[model samples]
Target: MTTVAEAASWARDLEALAIRISPRFCRLEARERARRYLAGLLAPLERKNGWQLAEAAGDASPDSVQDFLARMRWDADAVRDDLRAYVVEHLGDPDAVLVLDEIGFLKKGERSVGVQRQYSGTAGRIENCQIGVFLSYAGRHGYALIDRTLYLPQPWAGDEERRRTAWVPETVAFATKPKLGLTMLERALDAGVPCGWVAGDSVYGTDSAIRRTLERRRVGYVLTVTSGQRLWPGTVSDWVEEVPADGWHRLSAGDGAKGPRLYDWARLPFRGAPEGWSKALLIRRRLGDGELTFYLTCAPEGTALADLVWVAGARWTIESAFEMAKGEVGLDQYEVRSWTGWHRHITLAVLAFAFLTVLRKAAIKGRGPSRLGGRLDPADRARDSTPASPPPASADSRHLRRYRLVILAKTSSAESKAIALEAPYQNR
Candidate 1:
């Protein structure tokens, strides 16, 4: 485990990086204000006396943190673009897989955008919540968030009063998560990000529009599909000729001996399929666990088998990213009610997580201790030649020192002064 000092140092380093990425982040009334907001979320620090977590983070007052976030230009789109550029410049490999996924935030009330009695993947049951569609860039260098969209419920978008109350823009409209995901892909491609192929789950795979869009853009995709999804074996002409005048037939296949019957199989191009549909492979696999699944892809006609398998497997990275962000990095722990607060909190959480990820990778590669964890290591202290005594200790003394080092190294005398303007909220 990392020492307290080391953890605090890491937090400071993360704050500095956040400032560098968006200087406006540091300009928020107090310097440590933003740092405290992030540290409280990232570290397992206990709440301070007389300060509620929300109040301490500046979310209580009128000109509060929520308002600040609402007025800022650090919206989802801008943040996504900045992070995308960062990943490309610092993390991208020549061959990288762009992973797209949507995570649903289970909200309790119906007022928030897209909060309906619907299925939330997060809760694994029907619940009221906002769903966020996200796109991520993942490869050996590191993973960085690329895009996100708040799925507005039809009621919120269709009602002018509710829309105004939520501060949702007039142009905001209802669109399925998959549709929003497609827009994210288009934006990334328009920016000239070097993405080789796209990978997603059955939700995206089942959407003919998404698959066709990829085909239209000449982008390769490896997407999972339901066993019932139609596919044309060999060629389109073959399927067209085989279908009777009454269209296609759904064949019944047995799940087991004297067992439940299900669709055996069939591959056909989408009905009324548009032109430019690339020749894609239809594949099925029987896992060692006895689960059967299918996938569709257009990974060049004769690509090596190994390369095809690798592309198909890349989608798991996004899942891992989501798991780490929510579980380890506290992605869903914000207690805000406003849309702006939610967005800002999630963005900051993403940045904090990304910084830690970069640091961990650097540490593993023997690049030295992370700037956020201070320049010292517990292991290093063990090797010191000074006469040994009972090791220095405090509940949070180690972390406090590391945090101080990071702040000192990243914030200059002038920046420190600017940060100090917020006074009492500096550090507690």
Candidate 2:
């Protein structure tokens, strides 16, 4: 448990980071909102809704939070852009990746932007929900969602009355999740956000236009595809079925809660070669389960299987991130029904998550964890199994956010105290 002085110190650090990205005119009140809202989200409360956030802010009514989200003059996009720059500055690597995935936010009414009876991955069934395409940066250090765009279904897009009620802009039009992803990708690259690859599930992977866009941008990717998705060389299923018994190698995508997620992996040849790049069908079969998952990969020639496995495993970081955001920071606990309000809440939620993420990394840096784990400097890791050194603290910031934690799998028992306290995904 964190002591009073320690928790107070945590708030001050998070406040400074939040204030850095907060809009100029709203800094004073926004800093207060940032501190209280984040505390409420990280609090023991079951629901961090508007009323709860107001309570955290010591307000008598939820009106203040409602107004702040719906009518505040601050620019949501600018804050998002600032957060992106911060994440890149701290966690970005040339070998790092930008992961894309859509998450379902369940809603009861059709009034909410993009709400409809749709296929929701969250509920694992078709339900009335709004989907938001999110982009996360996964690197050697850590991963966090950096940006998002709510997916407005065609019904909401076509209904002018509904659009007006939700405060959706007239310029906003119907776009598939992949299209939304493409928009975010272009924005990141335009801002010179550093990353080497992109990864996503078949939803975005199967889109020819999305693949073409990545190809045009010369970005590498390891996106999952259906086994039946045909390739000129061979169907993914055909290639996986034909591989010899000795062809597979046991590798881990990354360390998980239980242990290293070990799987039998193989790479297949591509018939149609991409100009100045190579494409391969990578397959992973669960240990003793025989079930297989296929990924369509585009990268440089002779890219190590470890690298491909790393990217495949790294995609799960987004899932863990979603779990943390929703459970730890009110990512989906918003009461807003308007388009502007949804974006505003989401961007701020992401900002809050970023602050927690910085603290998480700082915890790791402070603890000086064994670099022997997969998360390490590539050259040092390749040279020997020796633990890599922690980075020097940044001169621009001084402090670490304090939170309770419990350690699990692959991590050292010695780190149990600090890792549990520092890991953003460690359950607030």
Candidate that would win on lDDT: 2
Q: Point out where model 1 deviates above 4 Å.
A: 1-12, 24-35, 46-67, 70-76, 233-278, 369-428
TM-score of each predicted structure versus truth: 0.68, 0.83
Q: Give per-residue lDDT, candidate 1, residue 314.
A: 58
Give the winner by TM-score.
2
lDDT of candidate 1 over 1-428, digit per residue (tens): 87797666666666665565554453555444556655555665353211344465655553555444465454444555666665565555444567778787776776665567877776788777777777877654556666666777777779887777677777778887788888888888888887667778888877888877877676667787776676654432234344333321122111223322222122322333224323444342232232445567654433333333445555766766777778655676655555566666677667666766767656654554443333335674344323222312433121111101011111211112211111101100
Which runs in model 2 stand beyond 4 Å of their true positions? Answer: 1-5, 24-36, 271-276, 367-428
- Model 2, position 101: C-alpha lDDT score: 95
The lDDT for every candidate, in the order shown, is: 0.56, 0.73
Compose the digit string of candidate 2's lDDT tens values, residues 93-120. Answer: 6656789999999999777888999999
Q: For residue 36, what is the lDDT in candidate 2?
A: 67
So what's the TM-score on candidate 2? 0.83
